[model samples]
Target chain A: MDADVRQMTWTELAALCTNLEKACTKQLKEEEARAFASLASFYASKRKAQGDASLDDLLALIEADLSTGYRSANEAANYADDRGAKRALLWGEKATKLLKSLLARYAKQKEALTADTGVFVCEICGFVYVGQQPPEVCPICKVPSFKIHEVKKEAI
Target chain B: MHAARNLRLCTKDCVCLFICPTGATNTETGQIDFDKCLDGCRLCVDACPSGAIYLVSSTYPAPQPKHPSVLETLYSLVRSKAAQEDVAHSVKEGSDDAALRQICTVVETSSRIIAEDLWRESGYIIAQSEATRALLKAMISEHGTMEGFPRTEVEELLSRLS
Candidate 1:
């Protein structure tokens, strides 16, 4: 019951959501069950959408990530030791720079930027790379190719 | 280890209240009294029907040292998630549609939680070593010049960590 969402695949998450919905229904909590049903659907759709996400949706997600990065930077400063804080700062700066570049490119060639290229993120550093494949190693974090994850579009 | 309750999962069976010999779980506040709780006591934890009660380690293991490159990458991912949270928060604040707002709120919360987890994995949450302080100082001096960088927060954090 105590599952880590980060570790779960989208299908697993959808299954968990469906199971929770069933559990809620068993408890006669109809409203909660309905909410879980919706969540289950959302995850299912998100898995299907994957690389097929629209430009606007992708941009919006990137923007959201940028905001999240800023907050993480602050938290790292506050709670993390000096090394953690330094790394967080570096990550924040790099992500901001990358996002700015992406926004600029999007503004200039909206359709071209989204054309067929897949969006990949470095699992270690959160560096977003738009290409057919992620780099051999992350330029920002120096991690190998396996650590880079593909960005799946959520069907919200 | 001491027992704690997850209020969300709690069914209010009150079995813990009766089973806890030290009365640590029988408090006006929902939280278990750590001071009164006996180490390795499992009476209340085993008695709870809803499985809401669980033990938390009173002492944490020393954090492993992460490579500087790895730490940077981990923190970067944290930043990315945090940025997403900010975007979700803005959407939540600006959208008039209730459903859209709810979705945005969820996204915001989820992203923040993920970011916190990443922070913890970076070896900065539980214990601060001297290396951590030195790293913070180096960051302030090197990266503080970047636009919109939170130099003040870093400085404040440095003082607190000290």
Candidate 2:
């Protein structure tokens, strides 16, 4: 007997929730894209890295970076398949969790900027998110990094 | 329910969509349509060219033996509402307020999601595999997360483990 014969079954539940997940994921991706773009612009004006390196350049960098991780998980999963569900799940869980942990760590890094005195700022885009307000998720370039203009106040 | 998978690294092998018995796993546009996916079918999870699709259970109990869908819920709602209205009419005519509240509560659940009944996605996790099963066990007992998956389901899983 199907273990979950009582409910809609695992297959059915997956279908219903799949769409909801897609919607949320799309929003998240768009946010990520904008963040990368904004970061790229900041670097361009500050150090003036090179000529016309837009947000796409940064995204290309990210894609290049993640290729190995993506490939590794697939390889691991294949190895697990023959081994059994236990093995498959092991490979899946570890790979997924690793990525999840990475994302969590990245979020923490972005948050570290909170303690800064606000001197060195991102040059490409002079943007700062205030404590009271949530920054706009720039869809086009995708970064909300504050653009620094060298603010000089009282005695330094 | 987050990004079902990391689409960036997806190899576009298109095997998952084909392997999925139901049309649950699909990549219609550039992005995947996770909403169409049927959870627990891991055919796609196994078939995925890249282990991009990561599935996790929510912190709720397993639902009752029979989980009702939107259409089913809607039909039930209409029936419950009518029943409530009938009961309310009776109460107004000669019945008591207690009966009216009972009827009203039933009506409310019919229309909206019955939060209490909707357990987190689980019970199946126990059935996944050894590593996943182990991970799930840790999550259930160690995390102190009450998902509402039936005690029977857990018991059955434990029986198998032993």
Candidate 3:
């Protein structure tokens, strides 16, 4: 479903999740789970170790958590809907509750990372960097992060 | 050209309506469609003559705090190590904790760098319109160019969401 488009059929989504949950947990269905897991890798893999990784590793855990949470949700929602699928709407309702909790936790973590530009200054000419950390040597003053002044003063 | 800004400046002379080349500049509505405008054509931007039609590039995102001074990011990589230090200091007692903590740090630092890159790439806004300009600006800057950003693994979720 395109998120840009509004509205969805709760029954279809819940059914998808139920099948997804089953596929994710059992050994016979491991390959199917792996495929779904791969879909999730897009969001999870960015945070993994790399030559010049930026996001702290927490992204992967959240990604993984979302996968499981979603799978669990699909299963529960399916159960709720299965009484003749009349309960399909209820399943979607449950899914919302499940996701909101997860979203709140993720939001807190994301807020911390994005609260500021995550920039700092060179102690010398007071040069600032917005990426990960200050350079090994300040291009301007040829000083180190140690020598450069940190913008964040301890509000003493 | 200053669609929204000129909304403030227009004396309702409606001179812009006559000067605009493709009618890309709208006086009554106070909007200009960059997508509709020719690249580097500067007709509307030039037509405004109010100096209000600030030539805007469609490539970047919405305006941000302290637009990207590539110099700044380079400075960070060259001077700071708070990210590395944060990683080093998080000594998890258990194996799982250690691994989880490590991943968290990696994601955090990566997001920070990405945020910087995104901020820089997305900071171009128009002085022209505001109708959907601000909305589109937020969409573009956070999202990216109309041709759009690459389908990187990092942005895969967003792509899916879209």
Among all windows of ten consecutive residues in candidate 2 chain A, which has the lowest summed lDDT?
Answer: A121-130
Candidates ranked by DockQ, best first? Answer: 1, 3, 2
- If scored against the real structure, what TM-score would every candidate get? 0.37, 0.22, 0.24
lDDT of 2 by residue, B68-109 (tens): 232233222222322322332233234234322332222222
- In candidate 3, stretches whose alpha carbon ends up further than 4 angstroms from where it belongs are A1-45, A48-156, B1-14, B27-31, B38-40, B56-162
Docking class of 3: incorrect
Task: Report the number of the highest-lDDT candidate.
Answer: 1
TM-score of 3: 0.24
Best by TM-score: 1
Q: What is the DockQ of each candidate?
A: 0.05, 0.01, 0.02
lDDT of 1: 0.57
DockQ of 2: 0.01
What's the lDDT for all of these models? 0.57, 0.34, 0.35
Q: Could you give the CAPRI-style class of model 1? A: incorrect
Q: Write the per-residue lDDT of candidate 1 for residues A1-156, one digit (tens) a residue.
A: 112345444444444445445544443445555655665555445443233323355366556555764455555455545565566556645744575566567558654664667666665555667789888998877988887776543434
- Candidate 1 regions off by >4 Å? A1-156, B11-15, B81-111, B125-162
Q: How many backbone collisions does model 1 have?
A: 17
